[model samples]
Target: MAKPKAKLETLQDKEILTSELAAIVGKTPQWIRQLTRDKVLNQVSRGKYNLGEAVQAYCEHVSGGKEEEQKPRLIDFKTRYEKTKAEKAELELERIKGNLHAAADVEWLLSDMILTIKTRLLGVPSRVSTECENESADVVESVVRREIETALSAMAKYTPDQIGGDVSHGGPEDS
Candidate 1:
């Protein structure tokens, strides 16, 4: 006995049910219905579908195939400019603070030297006595002068410009 040949029918513009689509896709009928309900697959007609459109929609959903939306980045030109400006201001403030500390140290050293010389001169009893003794006065004056000269020379070697300002302040007019 011989078997009969299968007939080939031309497809028409029509709709199919979930069971028929599941047969074409080789999935369970219930899974096809779920996909339709989730809108991953859309119905072209009631209880029917287009095979090509269904496959396209399923591929798009599974392949991370959404159109990319452009978003603005958080870091822009204005933000960078403001950050750089802040860093520069902080550096400048540090420099000014350093200069102020240096000036204070210079003033402190000058004051300490002046006080030491004054104390030494007062220790000479004859110089502080009621009688104006010429010899004791000369000795005190000579010692004070030598000490002031040494202090000024040391200052000039370390900070010439500052010492020059002090020297220019108390002097006769230069010819």
Candidate 2:
């Protein structure tokens, strides 16, 4: 039988001096003192130190595992979506207000045109044609009215399930 190998003893209370550590690390003792002064290495007892713990701490520092170098947590897409939706809602509200103002102007223009037509029809030279010579205004007004009707029809078309409401609505296309 082969002779039993000698068991190695664990070093629990073993320590090294600052000069010894500097010699092992191939640095000056003054540099070790600077490390201690910078709090990179804690002084356990005067100049004596735990070389194992110091090496481990130095390794961690050089490897960039220091607490201050941790990455910040990132925000997820759902939060970004909610933020964008809120901004879109604000913009939509402004757009609706502007549309309301424009609708008021259109109503005023249409009212004024109807009043002029009524007055002209009531009292005008028989030879003079009261009918508008320019069809562009009528065409524009008709186009606007058609677009508004189409939008309203689109809104009306949504069923309760589609609109998240109670009534079953049909669009012009459905009709």
Candidate 3:
């Protein structure tokens, strides 16, 4: 017995399967599936796409043109993203460590400076008494107060940063 021939339908706007479209476009079925998933090719129905529209969309995509709804590529954060996050965290830790070291050095400098100032202040009256050996107690008191005020005023004129350098920036030699 002879098999009957398949009838050819003359539908104008016929839709085709992704595999059929892929064959027509000379591309793989996977490529066509990707295009559909990317929304580059408009699917008319589930697992079916308008052949004419798909061809037009594919041509536009190939020519660097986009449709009304531009699909953004989804980013996967499990690979390079995790590595970048770790790098940023390490850089932040190093920066914090450097700042801590700078803070410690500044604290040491400030304490040393304060100790020197206090020593000078404590010795001021004795030094003044030697300068005015024969002066009255009242005279000595007045001179000490005036000298202390003048020294404090001079010290007040300098800012903390200005007073903070040691041998490196030519301020004072650190022992």
Candidate 4:
């Protein structure tokens, strides 16, 4: 006598272990577990899944079915914000560069003006000696020294107004 075997149901909708489902979906077993935890994919048992349903659910999630519209808006806003930030940084850098060049130019001009003033002051002793030439050499030397000392003292006390660069006085026509 032969024992008869009962036929199993068809395997199209069969349950599969998580590792098997992951292999079918080309994903890690841990990813299958995460989907089950997030309720994106349903589990058939502690470590099993309905392979067909899991694949469908994962497809829907990856497609961003209900959130597609908002995603583009978020990406666009981030791009615009980064572009504006870069433009503002560039403008600020240009302004700082301009300020540095202007400061350098002002410093150069002031240095040149100071050198010119020093050259004029050095000529004073020769001019004074010539003017007092009728006197004895000792007296002329003493007078020149006294005159130069007086001029140097006056220069030390001089404000920009005395030398012609005062802004507040407006112009020579104002005097």
Candidate 2 TM-score, C-alpha based: 0.32
Regarding lDDT, does 2 or 4 come out ahead?
4
Q: Candidate 3: misplaced stretches above 4 Å? A: 1-101, 163-175
lDDT of 4 by residue, 1-175 (tens): 9888887755646789999988888899998888888888888778877767777887877665335644554445667899999998887786666532334444444554555557667777787768777778888878767766765665465443233324343323243
- Using alpha carbons, what is the TM-score of model 4? 0.34
Query: Model 1 TM-score?
Result: 0.30
lDDT comparing candidate 1 with the true structure = 0.61
Candidate 3 lDDT over residue span 14-37, tens digit each? 789988889988999899889888
List TM-scores for all candidates, in order: 0.30, 0.32, 0.35, 0.34
* Cα lDDT, model 1, residue 170: 31
To one decimal, what is the Cα RMSD in angstroms of model 1 from the true structure? 18.8
RMSD of each: 18.8, 17.3, 11.7, 15.8
Model 3's lDDT to the true fold? 0.71
- A best-first ranking of the candidates according to their TM-score comes to 3, 4, 2, 1
The whole-model lDDT of each prediction reads: 0.61, 0.59, 0.71, 0.67
| Predicted candidate 2 versus true structure: per-residue lDDT over 78-171, tens digit per residue | 5677899999888778666653233444444444445545554444333122332445777656654555455455445533233211133222
Greater-TM-score candidate between 3 and 4: 3
Q: What is candidate 1's lDDT per residue for 1-175, written digit by digit as tens?
A: 8888887543533466788878877789898889889888899877788767776776675554454556332344457789999998887786566532344445555664566556655554433343344547686667556655655564455442342224343312221
